[model samples]
Target chain A: AQSVTQLDSHVSVSEGTPVLLRCNYSSSYSPSLFWYVQHPNKGLQLLLKYTSAATLVKGINGFEAEFKKSETSFHLTKPSAHMSDAAEYFCVATKGRDDKIIFGKGTRLHILP
Target chain B: SQTIHQWPATLVQPVGSPLSLECTVEGTSNPNLYWYRQAAGRGLQLLFYSVGIGQISSEVPQNLSASRPQDRQFILSSKKLLLSDSGFYLCAWSASRDSPLHFGNGTRLTVT
Candidate 1:
């Protein structure tokens, strides 16, 4: 079974400050991890993905996440939080050929101006 | 450059009504398709998936059903709508087993 857990349900930060959205995953094998963001009434956009090749992944909108095997974490981070960065973030895990995807509860990020 | 499209961006229906949502993919062949639902303020839940035409696998048991009549077309249906069926439905596809799933714009369905 593969699963993911988001460490926070809500995170608040000031504009231009660094942001961190924590995610941890559980997998029986080498699973692929992804970060997706959704704005109000909009579709989900892929932020990043982690395969066996890369431990550090960068994504759109100045976002990035690091895949750590020792800690079992793939926390999303941003160098600077912009006002348009307010959205819901989801951490997902899936194993190849298994055709299964598991998502975390989600973390709502609030950017304060 | 593969693209997926889901129809009826927003739908409002009454209880017991029949439901049908269509999805189509372009610029790809024999892609893996999936149907997912997101409840209010919740994460996505996988409902169904298909690897090829006329082949479907269900992940959860619910009032909804899925079909893959053509290589690039996937449909989600329900004989009778339920109040609990209200959510954002998303259609997605992947090039192969090792690729990441790309999602469509999604449909917001509301059952009254």
Candidate 2:
């Protein structure tokens, strides 16, 4: 079974501070990993994806994630936080394209100005 | 470029009323379609998926059902609405295997 676990249900950070949302996955095969962000009343936007490429992947809006197979983790990070970055973040894992993608419980980020 | 549309944006239905949520995709063909539901303050739960017309796969057993009558049209239905069914329903599509799924704006269904 493919599954993802988000460590934090909620995270708060001051503006211009670094942000980290942790995630771990369990999959039998080399799976594809992804991070998605959902803003208020908006659809989920893909922040980044890992498809067996470089271990470190950079995504839109200065967001990045590292896929560490040894630890079975794919944690999302940002060097600086902004108010607009406050939203629900989801970690996802899939066995393959044909398989169903599993979603984590999600972490709600709060940015303090 | 591909787009997924799901409507009506919000719905309030009585417990015994029948429910219908429709979704359509454009600028793509033979895409994989999916229906996901999110409860209050919860993550997404995959309800159903379709790889082709008249082909639907249910990920979890529930009161809801899904159909793909056309290549890009997917519909979710229930004979009778339940309070437990009230949630945000999202429709999504993927071009091919291993591709990231694109989501619709979503429909908020409130069963009262």
Candidate 3:
């Protein structure tokens, strides 16, 4: 079984400030993790993914995440938040070569100008 | 280059009415397809997934059903809609089990 846990349900960041969204996962085998963002009334977009490659993965729109095997955590972060970054973010995980992708409860990011 | 398409961007129907949401993938063959429902303030919930034609695996028991009539076409259906089914329905496709999923612009389902 594979599952993900988003530590925060909501996060607020001011424009030009740093942002962080914490996530953790549990899996019986090596895990494939991902970060997706959903804008209002829009589809989910893949921000980045970790497939047992580099622990620190860079994604689109100046976002990045680090996968810590020891801690079982993959946390998303950005140096400066933008207005367009305000959206619902999801942490997803799946065990090696499994079609079952488990999703976290999601964290709503609010960007303040 | 691959793309996923979902129809009926928004739909509002009364309870007990039937529901159908169509999803298709282009430029990819034998891709893994999935249907996910997201509710307000809640996360995404996987409803079904298919690896090939006529092979669908349901994750949860609900009033809805899924079908993969063709290699690239997946459909979500329900004989009777329920208010509890109101949410955002997303269609996604992946090249393989460990590949990243590409999602379509979801369909907004509102069952009143």
How many steric clashes does model 2 contain? 1
Superior by DockQ: candidate 1 or candidate 2: 2
For model 3, give the TM-score of chain B. 0.99
Better of 1 and 2 by lDDT: 2
| Tens-place lDDT digits, model 3, residues B27-54 | 9899999999988878888899999999
For model 1, residues A92-112, the per-residue Cα lDDT tens digits are 887777646778999999999
> Please, what is the whole-model Cα lDDT of each candidate in the order they appear?
0.91, 0.92, 0.93
lDDT of 1 by residue, B1-112 (tens): 7888999899999999999999999999999999999999788888999999999999999999999999999999999999999999999998776577888899999999
Q: Which 10-residue span in candidate 1 chain B carries the lowest summed lDDT? A: B94-103
Candidate 2 reaches a DockQ of 0.67
A-chain TM-score per prediction?
A: 0.96, 0.96, 0.95
DockQ ranking from best to worst?
3, 2, 1
lDDT tens string, model 2, B5-81? Answer: 99999999999899999999999999999999998899999999999999999999999999999999999999988
Q: Is the docking of candidate 3 incorrect, acceptable, medium or high quality?
A: medium
lDDT of 2 by residue, A7-38 (tens): 99999999999999999998867788989999
lDDT of 3 by residue, A44-77 (tens): 9999999887999999999999999889999999
